[model samples]
Target: MTINETLIEKKFSNDLTEAELLEFKKLYETDDAFKQEVDFLKNVQRVSETEDDALFRNQLATYETEISPKKVFLNSKWIKPFSAIAAIFIITISISLFMNKDINNDSLFSSYFEPSKNVSAPIVRSEKDEHLTNRAFIAYSEADYQQATSLFQKAFEQTGNSELLLYEGNALLAMDKVTEAIEVFKTHLTYSDALTNRTHWYLALAYVKSDQLDKAKQELTIYIDSEEKFKKTEAKSLLKKLK
Candidate 1:
């Protein structure tokens, strides 16, 4: 379509060179309308392209939210960190799983695991899409975890809000930043019981992603016993796999 859209597609597709990435960032920094257009495209492309991104994005907001420019700029603070997240790959393992009785954890994890898609319920405070909260929801719904995390954090900062903290954590987990996600969820748990069951289920999945099987099983046990029917079937299946 447009030159900006082409550049953004290249950036997300990991086809941009060092020089192009730098120049693109320059455009991103100076052009607000361009940024929003690019974000809207990203929302469309990411969701329509894969079940993985769509599932994760849905996990960000339990309800619908909108996007805007100022909030998008607040989110731009995280674009650099996303370079790291995008660079990640499951490195090819040379070890033999059957012969040596050892398998690559990455391969093992990939075989049966996907991030839990559960999301915190939307607390529709303020006017619809008024500020950081709605922007954060929009980012997450678009699978823009990098921006979503930043917006969620900024939202939390504005009000000392714990529910936004839950969103930040969920966004991180979706990004596969498991360790950081764990702490955020734990903090949210301490501050509020609003989404206790959802938190437990997601926390358990975080442990699974991080290879903390024992801890995951423990959390899953708590979730299962708590009668959180929302994910009981999925939880039982995952728990059985863990055992």
Candidate 2:
């Protein structure tokens, strides 16, 4: 099956191999045709599920006001029938909520995306061989992402140091190369045990940039639950936005 066709199934099933995942990243970053295909499929799926987004939201608001907050006295005879009716009402509204196209996770991505904080800025690099690393950090701090991305990658290749990898990912992000940043973090997390919570924060932001709502949600879940979560407050706030 074509990647686009597989993407539709994967969206629901949440079962993408690493290579297919990379294809999504590539398409999202580089391919206008593929991007449109994904968007069209998303809209089609949403439209298939919901006729009107505003109406869907309104109905849910109504149901929430009527159903969830009340103390239902189920033991009383009149209340029992009312409860049964309410249950049916809830099931119907729940279906509507899921199917609505306008009820999307991407609406808040822009509002929630601030640059993930620089946690490694305080360290001093002081080696002759580490001149590129120092320059990369300087360029990164100055927001010269083009230079930083190149320098950081060079340092990473020379040393296999996780710090360079992390900073390179950050540079990729500053350059708006988010999918590449995500891949860098994915590899770093898999291979290096050094960068932890902060790396996850960057990964989640990369997912947010890619508009991969579910993937972002997963990483945010890790952040929210982690005691050492570098972006705990941000993750909590972003989760609220996503939901």
Candidate 3:
């Protein structure tokens, strides 16, 4: 059926089947002009359906008496001026109301209007021992591996904390500096106590990155035997993958 006929039938009919609605949706997707005409008809039908009968009858009478072709002010020069005056009055009232709104300077509204401050928590530089560790973590989170490595190096100079060394090693690994990462991890292992299960796993990963499969397997063995069940499980999986 033609688009116009389909739209008229949908508008006047009370009970369109599901199939007819689907067909109308398909037509709307494929034809923009058909969709516009359908939308206009739907809006007209909605206004007629919701209009108060008394108000509509009064409006019809007014239209016949004062707005008919013979009686209407079609050529009056004052019509444009009256419309312009009405528009200006509406705009002025809108601006006045908008400007006179009760602004709460002391409330949360002031926070939105004020410029934001850089109130981020200061970088935790508590001690020489923790300074590099904290800075490395911040740099890693910010995806600044080079800065993290430099900070990690400075931290290691003052306090050779295995954890800080591991951070440096991990940063090197992230930068694809595998040989440097391997050296850092190995240095940590030389001084690290037997309780350092996490370090062993990370060292194993560094070894894998360096293509030292045998060393990676040996480190994974130490990691898998540790009491930390989670790290041991992860190490076992890596060992299986290496094999």
Tens-place lDDT per residue, model 2, 4-36, is 657645643567788878877787779888777
lDDT of each: 0.66, 0.67, 0.60
lDDT of 1 by residue, 1-243 (tens): 567766776776677989889888899889998788667656644434433343433433222224433333212222433322332211112233333333333444445444434254453445555677777777777788999899889888997767677678878877878899999888877875556666777787777667787998998898899956967887888889778
Q: Count the backbone clashes (under 3 Å) in each candidate.
A: 0, 0, 0
State which candidate, 2 or 3, has the greater lDDT. 2
**Candidate 3 weakest lDDT stretch, 10 residues:** 112-121
lDDT of 3 by residue, 165-239 (tens): 766777787676878977887787777554355667777776665557788899889878777564565577668
In candidate 2, residue 67 scores what lDDT? 78
lDDT-better candidate, 1 vs 3 = 1
TM-score of 3: 0.44
Candidate 3 colliding pairs: none
